[model samples]
Target chain A: MSANVKQKRTLLEWVRGYTGQKYITTVLFLLIPIVLLTLFTLIPAVNMVIFSFQERDQLGVNPKWIGLDNYVTLFTDPTYLSTFKNCIYYFFGSFIQLALALLIATILCSKIKFGNLFKGILFFPYMMNGVAVSLIFRRFFQKGDGITNSEGTLNTILALFGLDPVKWLSTPGLVNVCLVFASIWRYIGFDIIMFIGAIQSISPDVYEAADLDGANGWQRFWYIVFPSIRSIVALQLVLAIKGAASVFEIPYIITGGRNDTSTFVIKTIDTAFVYKKVGLGSAMAIVLLLIILIITGIQKLCFRERK
Target chain B: MAENKHYFDLKDYTFKETPKSVRILFQVLKYAFLVVCCLVVIIPLIIVLFGSLKTHDEYIQSNVFALPAVPQFSNYVTAFNQGNVLRGLFNTMIILVISCFGTIITGTMTAFVVQRFNMMFTKVVKAIFLIVALLPSISMQVTVFQIVNKLGLYDNMAAPIIMYIGTDIIAIQIFIQFLDNISVSLDESAILDGCSYPRVYWSIILPMLRPAIATVLVIKFVGIYNDFYTAQLYMPSPKNAVVSTALYTFVGPYGAKWEIIFAGIIICIIPTLVIFLALQKSIYSNLVSGSVKE
Candidate 1:
């Protein structure tokens, strides 16, 4: 009995030693990511919050604390707040993109020939550099100089259809629509890929049962597919909302945020870099961050209650 | 049923017993939608290809879709030289290589440690990553810019490289999920054989992580390569131009020569398109697994 007890004690000691060694390895391995994360993400995030409350006079100089002044300007300034209205165009565009992506993804996940080829072609845009896409679409929507008699790709197609050419990028009201349209084209591929993945993950047995039960196509989709992929849809909804609010590249590259097509992010970047209003730009960024956080929080609560 | 075990194949039977007319109509509509989407995607790309070969006179005289009378291969050469695309490609390659290596190492290590060890510290690290991911990284760029400047990393390639390595939440998630799939007994067996935990990780864990690494590497490469904002903001110098920024050089306030810009766009697109086509299968599945596993 004593011998057995002694062996047990030794085994217990060995297990303790194993755990101690494991903990040491964990700390050692975690060192680099922790250090880098702190230096880059944590420190910068804290400094951003501080910068939002301070005023900077010059580049490379220290900023002075000006409590609530930057926040006050952001709320009161018409020029600053007006850019957020542009997000509405993109917000609505994102929903349209989501719906189309869902439809296409669902179809692709079904009995379609050339499904792989179609997916490849559709997803190719997401792989292309954003700047390249912006440039391509810029030419796509070019307004013809009547003197030169040259028309943009879209207008030429319109002319072919016996419809008069429309000023795609020049008209103030229509320009955001064009910009949002481009945004959808670039991003809808991502949504399709994501939705297709979600749709495909549904087990075939489930579908087989639905088929045996004489479930029609629409019935199967509405009852089974919709519920199955609802989580991804919810997650993507939040992502789409954030993306719309913070849209920067398409409009920034195509229009350079000119002609009232500036989104919140472009305006913030310009305010900080172009206009040298660092404090105000930081405040704008913080506001945008808060808005995103609130949206995410609401989504979580809504999802939880539904579940 | 044996041959058609894939989910898509299983879906075909559901349509089989339906009335033939409705089935045919649905099939046609599906093809129609797909074909239209494909055309919409391909047309803009085709126009760029056509425009790149056209002469200045031809571009101005013809509509956007008209094919070039003669292919001007020299336009690519001109864009190559004038747009500084070669230099940009070189710089982007440098950033891609270092950042990919760093992200894989740091991401895998964090995943291995956190998932294998059940501890309060591990929980905290996981929570930290989740919170950071939720916080919009773009909105905080203003302060990151200041930090980069203060650290004297402005206009330095290391600036973007470090940021890319550090800010990879998706990579960590991918790694963690992969580690979870790996049996813990493998590590324990190695440990039982008098191997240290680090040894177990190196010999057993790292080898098993090949698929995950490939997924992470491909995803990281594409993301870092296509990134224009970080490359533009941090390293704005002509000498420091990456592929995306190099293309931006052609943009002017007045009308740019469209042919050359089109050439530049083509040059930037070919590398990614080739990669995508070659790894199309794995890329799709890996992206799906990584994302949905989250």
Candidate 2:
């Protein structure tokens, strides 16, 4: 009887050891990722807010505590304010992109021939390197001498039509237009893909019913498809708007933000890296973050209410 | 089928309610629009291809759409030699391999531990990950720059690798979703057979996660390969240039030679084009799944 009791105690200890080991395993597995996140993402996020408050010449140089000045400058300064206004061009452009994507997605889902081929060709550009695409467009929109303008592809086409070679890059009025076009070309494919998925998910019974009821294609699309994909549309719009506010690579590479074409992000990067105004740059970043956060918060509220 | 036969099975009906002329017009319009869109997308690529093969004077004097008199394949050689294309590709490959593997391991381990354990700490961790996903990564990059510099990892490949591995929320989400489908009985039975938790995870749980891993691998590979901002910012030196940044050598404030730049662009585009063609189907499905999950 004593031996049985001892065996029970030993078994209890073994089970206890097993539980303890599992706990250790959990901690061990989580330890590196958590530490990395804290070091990289979490700390930087908090420090960004902190840096927005302090005035620093460089990133970590001699710093003076100047609360709200950087933010004040960010808000009141005309140079910075103009960049935020520049997003309007992209904001408007995104609506056009979404509309086009929706139209094409509807067509593609309607048993169209060569649908896969069309999609593959259209989406190929999205997979290319951003810098390379920017380079391609840079050559594509180059200004050419009117008499023998043979280099710029767009200009060459214009020349073919007996039209004058317009300065696509140098003109301030047209530069933003050109930038918006590039943004659309790179992103419309993504919007198309998303819309196609949403459209395909709609049940066929609804379409069948619409057909049997003598409804035309337009009526079917208007009453059924559009309303069904409203959530996806809303989500894509939110993302596109968010993307508009942070338009960076295309302008940064194509025009290098010259000729009043700087977006908010390019301005932020220039302020920090080029001008060495780390504090002001941090404040600009915070403002950008606030804009994005507000947008996402609104989206969450809209989604919750619908539910 | 018999019940629906009397109800007029509209699903199999070959006829549409729309008028014939309207249907024809719609079909014509759809084809016209698709053909035009496809041309608009393909024409630029064609221009690049043609321009890449032309001599310098041919590129300048001839129309952008004109065929080169001689297909100057040497332009590619010039681009490869002068642009440091090989080194850029090699550096990008290194970064891609290390970061992708690191992400998979860390992401899977975190998912396994969180899903297996019903602890408060795990719940908080999950919440933090979700919130971080909502946070805009670009806005916080200002401070990230400073931190990396402070860590003395400036201009090093390790900087981007670590950031890529750490900042991935999508992989964790994918893994967690995948883990939910996996039966806990596998782990339990192994445990009952004297298998330790880590052993069960390594031997059983890891093998079951192959599909999720492939999805993450493709997404992460394409993202890391095509990334310009991080590589351009972190790995700025010519020796450390990535495929994206390597093309930057040909173009800048000063005017560039269009032919060589075109050659470099083509050189950079080939790898991704090949990968896309090879994994086209999986990529489309994976992207849709990832976005829907998000």
Candidate 3:
């Protein structure tokens, strides 16, 4: 072979040593996923941050790069302001939902038979299509039809005890109340599973020692179990809140953004596609992203301190 | 005799004939609680079944929990009448099949690179993984919507297929944990033997990744099967809808046809249920096995 041929072969051989075919394979596998993430996730995120400050004209294509004009509009807009207020209202459910799930998980974990079976059953709702569940609720919540007339599950059971029916779906604030129920139904199992796994990771020996010292059931729980799984609790709380705030499918499909259920997510979609104000919608999403980031950063700090 | 009887005091006694009735009472309570909990889980499913039998007018007259006065199975036929259920099913299957394979392959490769390779920019790569994990799904939604819309893939299944593979950090994270259990000595031996890293991975490491592979496959399959959000956002056109979306269309914005909605819901549930039942053991045990460890 010529010297040039030898040199090329040697270079190929060296590349082979450093990375082998794995490097090329690695690059190939990472290519599509990375490109998609960069274009869709990273670039869009940057555009959103930029768009939130800009104003768009009638055509809705070009952003006129106004100085926080969109943000100014956001504060003045009733739909925007009300939904933002409702966002805080929505946050209350997250706390209760997580707490409720955590409580059930705790009870079930404390020597319940077929804990795995129970956990599986509880998580069944999570597997459901959110839209499907929402439809079920819509009928169940129909004014004077399901709840008041005892046609829905809750009202039927209540009526059996000789109580009046409730117009569950038609009630103003009850929409959120039903959302909590739906959320709690779907997520309680997940919270329990996560907590159970974390709680189970605590050695039985610690509980046994506490028992030997005559620590009561509640005492053992507080002193021994609580401190042990603090980190896991922090993780669960953060994830649960994150899940709740991002909720769109249930409200969108079930209620169709009616009855005060138009959350940040619902309105964001509307502002973009429905209202044809893509720039404004993108700006709103950017604000949401910032809120999520701040919350996550706080959670990390909390978790770190917990450790 | 009295002293001897006192020795057999209450502290040392098992359930006696005197407490036998109480024992039975407690046993009944146990079963009752168990049944109630199970009822809570299955009630929604039962309602869906009974609701589907109601005629559109009956659905309006009766509450959701009311028994169907007439058991009409034609709601299912009605559900089919709205659109081509079979076509949507086919489209969903195609998207699922492609994405399932893509997720498995790409997920495995990413995990392998992050765990096995010690590149100069390992820190940067690892940081990216954390960012993906820590970020909320909605945080990424805006960007995805704008770009996918701009690229003119809004009505296509390709968007979700790509998203599944791209955002699948959990499977990779799980695989990394599994890989940690594997001794690195085998890879070292392969290197000494002049086997390339790709060759080593494919021939040696990939075989060991079977358990992780099974976990990722089963979990992702279930996720895509029941997925509504991505399908709704990206594939809004009716013809391209998945089962989840097809069911939603039946219950359109104006008024829901309960019978058809129920039929669609039941139809959607059966596939996932059968798959889950067959692999319940693996799914249950996979979650239990060394996840979230320090």
Candidate 4:
């Protein structure tokens, strides 16, 4: 007992001595996570940029220095060009997503009963796993056997309306649309929650003043609500663009990058693992990163100018 | 006869409100839109749930809207055994606990030091994190995979746990914001009372950071649970597979068998759904505050 007490005293004394050097202790605390972050995140990111320039195998072995050839091929390749076009579809989908979310959020923000229930139900899908969502939507969009066969929920609904079953996944042109719809279904709730928060943050005095001015609902929303949520809207726009560019899970799982739904990230993964062209894949990823950076920069500038 | 007195109407005296008919119309429209949105969100999920209860022949024979003649409760049993869900759940729980605690400790510690100290190096570190947050992480996966392999972390459960704990910039940001709000005088008082810096962190600061810690814990837990891509890439072996990757077996082995796949998805989602429903208020509010405060 005496030895244990003495040992504890000495440990306390040592800790006291250590704490006397406050700055050093502070540095020590910060050092650990920072080093881990550098090792796992920062260095790997820098290595990605470096790998973009070096020709390497999928396993990252036998590197040969190849300059801008990967970038050149990436830009000129027909398949990759189509992927960029598909990104535009997702970009448009993001706009629709934002608009729809904004509408729902606005309505929910108004005086209504069961608002919480509505919000909860709407936001449920955002909690779902990407793989699970893909599976659910895959089953939902399955084509029926005959005009009366109920192969999928969608086909059942279509048959009820006396319409032919839509080839949601199989058709080249329709596949991207279906994937975009699924993305919207999964992600729109997040935007709604964000918009609701932003809308709620705006002081009610502004709305009351607008009401005193005899403003209609549409006019009030246009002049008051829209301006209040502009920053969030801008942020979501950038995020949407980023999401559209790097979309992977839905198309990758549903169609395995088939039927014109291949995204840039999907293509990058294919190039790296499937084709064993790590160098080219790294270049493609870098290009996508640069594109995102440029787009985000432009958005910042636009928002800044407006301010 | 005394003149009859006319009472002043409060409604007329006040500012003109929306017409009652228009208000009713708006209410009707609002409910209609909300119902449609709810259906859009839930109809697919409901179909999946019902589909899971049906057998293969029944699924093909009946419309998706049709209720199963006899619910196949055994599908869940088969899915649990064949899909390796039990093992996956165990592995995922282990990873989630380790990574969640790791994230919280590191995030709070870093935030505490950065907020308490006014050093050039700390500022640089903060700037590095900010820049990293702006960059797209998925784009760097190729090199990350290489780094993981070089470190011999590939196919190890530790790889995802390490990556998750180290790569969470949002948690650090949230913690720093919370720490900034906490007055520095508390730390000074603890120090003056002969408490060591680490002791001050443990006794004074950490207890005060309960809300922030809860927010970060929920967000990180859900994000890690739903993540399939990282787990699939780093921990591909069956023994090391987490929940998301383990669920992938259904897709691969039970291809085109929507009934079993639905069952597997339900099994995967049940825990998260229950948690979300139970903590809906805290989770939703935290998510809102975390995003909106930025």
Candidate 4 residues A139-232, lDDT tens each? 8888876432356888778889998888888988788888999999999989998988888778767766866887665677778878889999
Q: Compose the digit string of candidate 2's lDDT tens values, residues B115-219.
A: 888888898998899888866676577788878898999999899999999999889999998898999999889989989888988999999999888889977
Candidates 2 and 3: which is better by DockQ? 2
List lDDT for all candidates, in order: 0.85, 0.84, 0.69, 0.82
Q: Pick the candidate with the highest TM-score.
A: 1
The residue ranges of model 3 lying beyond 4 angstroms of the native Cα positions read A1-3, A19-26, A57-60, A110-117, A144-150, B1-37, B55-70, B81-83, B253-256, B285-294
Q: Could you give the C-alpha RMSD of every candidate to the true structure, in order shown?
A: 4.5, 4.1, 5.7, 6.2
lDDT of 2 by residue, A164-271 (tens): 888898898699999898888888888888888887777777767876798765677778878888999998899989999999989999999999999899999888
Fraction of true A-B contacts recovered by candidate 2: 0.57
TM-score of the second chain of model 3 compared to its true counterpart: 0.84
Q: List the candidate numbers ranked by DockQ, top first.
A: 1, 2, 4, 3
Instruction: Please report the interface RMSD of model 4 to 1 decimal.
Output: 7.4
Ranking by lDDT: 1, 2, 4, 3
- Give per-residue CA lDDT, model 3, range A85-173, as digits (tens): 55555567778766766565665555445756766777666656566677766655554443223366667667779998787766888
Find the candidate with the highest DockQ and give its number: 1
Top candidate (lDDT): 1
Deviation (Å) of A49 in candidate 1 = 1.2
Candidate number that wins on TM-score, 2 or 3: 2
Measured against the true two-chain complex, the DockQ scores of the candidates, in the order shown, are 0.55, 0.46, 0.30, 0.36
| Native contacts, share recovered per candidate | 0.69, 0.57, 0.33, 0.53
Candidate 4 backbone collisions, by pair:
none
